[model samples]
Target: MPQSVDRALDVLDAVAASDGPVPAKALARRLGCGLSTVYELLGTLTARGHLVRTPAGYVLGYRVPSLHLAFQRQMRMSGEVQELLHRTRRAAGVDTYFSTYRDGGIAVLAAATASHPATGGFTVGQDTTGHATAHGKVLLAALPRAARLRYLAASGMRAITPHTITSPERLDVQLRRVRHEGVAVEVEECAPGVACVAVPVPAAGAPTAVSAALPLEEFHRRGHQVAEALRQVAAEAATFQGTADISGSTGG
Candidate 1:
């Protein structure tokens, strides 16, 4: 059986699928639900700013801007995030990347490489487990509570490294620390020799993320220096094309 909240969400979906904002009676009929249920659901969705009404009919709310913002965030990250990765890689002479949380895991969308002791660079479309990488950890740390719970539930607690958090409770402790410190770290979670440091890229008005990935020794030797450059570039990049989701802001 459908749950109450699910029913409410269904009502919203019906309205959203409509050509225009629909009146309550027509909306109820379209949803194949009773008037009272439809009315209650519409009220709830409207209150959440996800649905709205106009002179003609019920429609998606003014906050369609927010949903657009989320879509824009994903696209922005695809293009501009690569720039940040290049900046950090160039400045620090280290491998750098941006990863986003995807399907209960982390996807490495872009990466830049600097010759460190003449090491090779990472390419695009390389996906990894969020539970196993520095970038993933930072993204995990930044997840909204509900999203985080959803990820942990689906991915389950497992050990990919000696340093990896094998339990949700322990992972929670570290994630809390990441939230407070505004950084996430991994000693050997993703690779034994590679240590990484990461930070979040907030999406106040759009899909948001945390950016990370680095080599351990050099990162420690000049982390603050690289990080300062990364932060500056991140800030500048955030202002790009008016596409950056500054509204999805995380307080500095």
Candidate 2:
């Protein structure tokens, strides 16, 4: 690739990985490039609608979501994964979600809803806090101790609900158990009256997870069944690794 192209891609990647908008100077420092070069690239990217530059900083532009949808359409899931997700949702009688830890947060990749939808309030492409959701906990648990601590500090450990874990020490213990049990569970942590259970799918890299959600009442009554169903699907998903390749194939 041309050097300019390489640098532009670097700039894009840095912005995409950031938790929020990134400034030009910060991009230059992170890319180890001159300020002038970063500025030129930023300008070009912004003109092309690949990035949006504001007083705060540069963020991914509107074009990115369209491109993402195009790529996802192109990267259609294999029959097995789709069937498994659907079957799990049907069997578990709740909403099933496939999410991944990316750029220091949660990305819900896909979801299958039950015929009688519950009030879990989840959707595809939804960004979620890493400290309050079962899927987030699975991802957090996979991180090295230092990185996990840094993320918690950056997140400020804000509580999403009364059940959310706001203390880093308490959450650290929970993350350890997530690792040991190969699963994570949340009881109204992310949202009131909603509960979730998730298991790690490291095969996709970056701590991807699959989860099932239902009402707190149903969860309390049949937590074991829901957990078992989620584990089965997660184990199957753990054998799959093509998602990252598909997502990256279209990258510059």
Candidate 3:
């Protein structure tokens, strides 16, 4: 690939991978490039509308979906999910999202914040444990059973909360259920008092999952109904499920 464009994209990735806007200098170190190169990349991407400058620093832009839409809707469905989350927050009360595969985990492609009546909570760029998250598991379910078994064995599902599946056996069971339901749930897993319901947004070009997270207390009160709402919202998003290819396979 062209080095300039690659560097520009690297900067964009760094921003997307963070919970908040990231400074150009920090982006420089992570990409193992010089400050000037980082700024140049940031400047270029921002100019092209892929990024924006914020008080926190630089963040992936909300317009990303529209830019990637039409041309690579399949590949860019993830961004549409984010855009949907941002909009759904108005209806579902925010706290909704779309996630995609990244570095053996799920990346937040889009999110809306109705998580609280106020501000200050997990940001849009957060990445959660694949096994622990309801949405994450939905994507995980797409993996071949044989490969899924191996991933769980090595990942050694951790106990994020009492509700989390800490064993391979239990995790496997949950994944099976997710496959059947076409949705996943995180009840106090990944974070205390946090729960999520998710559905797969299948796009062969750029596949991801659509999820809605809420305070655990609220989730228990509304998980079932919200799961349906999530489904409806997903209907508005693109469907993309490419062939299964979990990055690193291991033995179960």
- Judging by TM-score against the true structure, name the best candidate: 2
- Predicted model with the maximum lDDT: 2
The sequence of per-residue lDDT tens digits that candidate 2 reaches over residues 3-76 is 99999999998998786889999999999999999999999999988999888999999988878666445554
Candidate 3 C-alpha lDDT tens digits along 36-55: 87887788788888899988
Off by over 4 Å in 3: 1-75, 78-80, 102-104, 115-128, 153-156, 202-207, 239-252
Sorting all predicted structures by TM-score, with the top scorer first, yields 2, 3, 1
Tens-digit lDDT track of model 1 for 100-135: 555445555556765432132233443445665556
Give residue 188's lDDT in candidate 1 (0 to 100): 67
* Each candidate: RMSD: 13.4, 10.0, 6.6
Task: Provide the clash count, candidate 1.
Answer: 13
Give the range of the ten consecutive residues with the poorest summed lDDT in model 3. 242-251
**Candidate 3, backbone clash total:** 9
Alpha-carbon TM-score of each model against the true structure: 0.57, 0.64, 0.60
